[model samples]
Target: MPSLMDTYIENREMVQPNHANNLDTVHGGNVMKWMDEVGAMSAIRFAGKSCVTARVDEMDFRRPVLVGDTAVIESYVYEAGETSVDVYLRAFRENPRTGERELTTESYFVYVGIDESGEPSPVPALTVESEEGERRQAEALDGLDA
Candidate 1:
């Protein structure tokens, strides 16, 4: 079994001109790409196998990350089935100098563990062992109801 905390991952991307739109803000697609990458990493950590994205739930962008800001993507596996790992992901716009951060986007993703032949593979059971891990799992479950 793998603890939910074991699947946690955080990645940061610098928002540069190439990753931004004409308005000088990070593009929505770029944000999604970052989130997806982080989410997949979490799922793979939990599954211990190659994982392929199966589905992405509704994603909402609450704010734009301006160019020069750091895009911080955090993800963790909150739940899992026989072969599917459910990951919760959130992205924040961080000011490197001030260390201030604000939520920019969030989404839920599903990834299926795969074998060498491309068939679904079983994943170890996920456990929420710590108080913080339990809280995070609960929060992700609560968001699913909203």
Candidate 2:
């Protein structure tokens, strides 16, 4: 079994001109790409094998990340089936100068583990051994109802 903590992943990307839209804010597509990459990392950590995106449960961009801000994406595996890992992912817009951050987006991503032959493979069971992990898992489960 792999604990939720073991599957945790966080990444940061600086929003540059190339990643921005007409409003000089980070594009939604770029944010989605970042979420997918971070979510896949968490899934791979949990499954210990190559993983591919199976589904995106939902993606909501509540706020925009400005061109000068840093986009921080955090991800963790909350549950797993035989070949599927469900990951909770969230992004924040962070000000580098002030260290202030605000929630920018959130999404749930499902990944399927694959073997060397590129076929579906079983993933390890997810364990919420820590109280924090349990709380996170609970939150993720609750979000599925919304």
Candidate 3:
């Protein structure tokens, strides 16, 4: 089994585009795409198989990432079901040169594990041993309640 820390940042990306948006700032769709990709990677790492997005509870583009800036997204599994892992995803806009960052977006996603046959397969429960993990899990539950 991969260590807990390994599950946190495995196979992520730092996306930079021509600009944040076609008009001027970053595009909302591009941010969503990045979120989905990072979320899926967390699920696959935890489940040890392929996974697909089952649902996104909520996605909010609170801020815009400008062009030439870095869109750094972090994804980690916070909760799990028999065949699903709920991932907590957060994105920040960073100045590539200065390394300054600001929270730009966040969302909760649910993904289901798939076996070699491409059928839903069971995934282990999420194990939260640290305060941070617990807080993130709580945030996901609180999000569902809202």
Clash-forming residue pairs, model 2 = none
Which stretches in model 3 have alpha-carbon errors above 4 Å? 1-6, 10-20
Model 3 residue pairs with clashes: 19-67, 20-25, 20-26, 20-27, 20-67, 21-25, 21-26
Candidate 1 wrongly placed segments (more than 4 Å):
none
lDDT value, residue 92 of candidate 2: 99
Question: What is the per-residue lDDT of model 2 for residues 1-146, given as tens digits with 9 covering 90 to 100?
Answer: 88999998889999999999899999899999999999999999999999999999769899999999999999999989999999999999999999899999999999999999999999888888999999899888888888
Each prediction's TM-score against the native?
A: 0.98, 0.97, 0.85
* lDDT value for model 3: 0.79
Q: lDDT at 40 for candidate 1?
A: 91
TM-score of 3: 0.85
TM-score of 2: 0.97
TM-score between model 1 and native: 0.98
lDDT of 3 by residue, 17-79 (tens): 653445567778878888899889988999998999999876888888777777899888877
Q: Write the per-residue lDDT of candidate 1 for residues 10-90, one digit (tens) a residue.
A: 999999999989999998999999898999999988998899999999999999999999999999999999999999999
Candidate with the larger TM-score of 1 and 2: 1
Q: Where is model 2 poorest over a 10-residue stretch in terms of lDDT?
A: 137-146
Name the candidate that leads on lDDT. 1
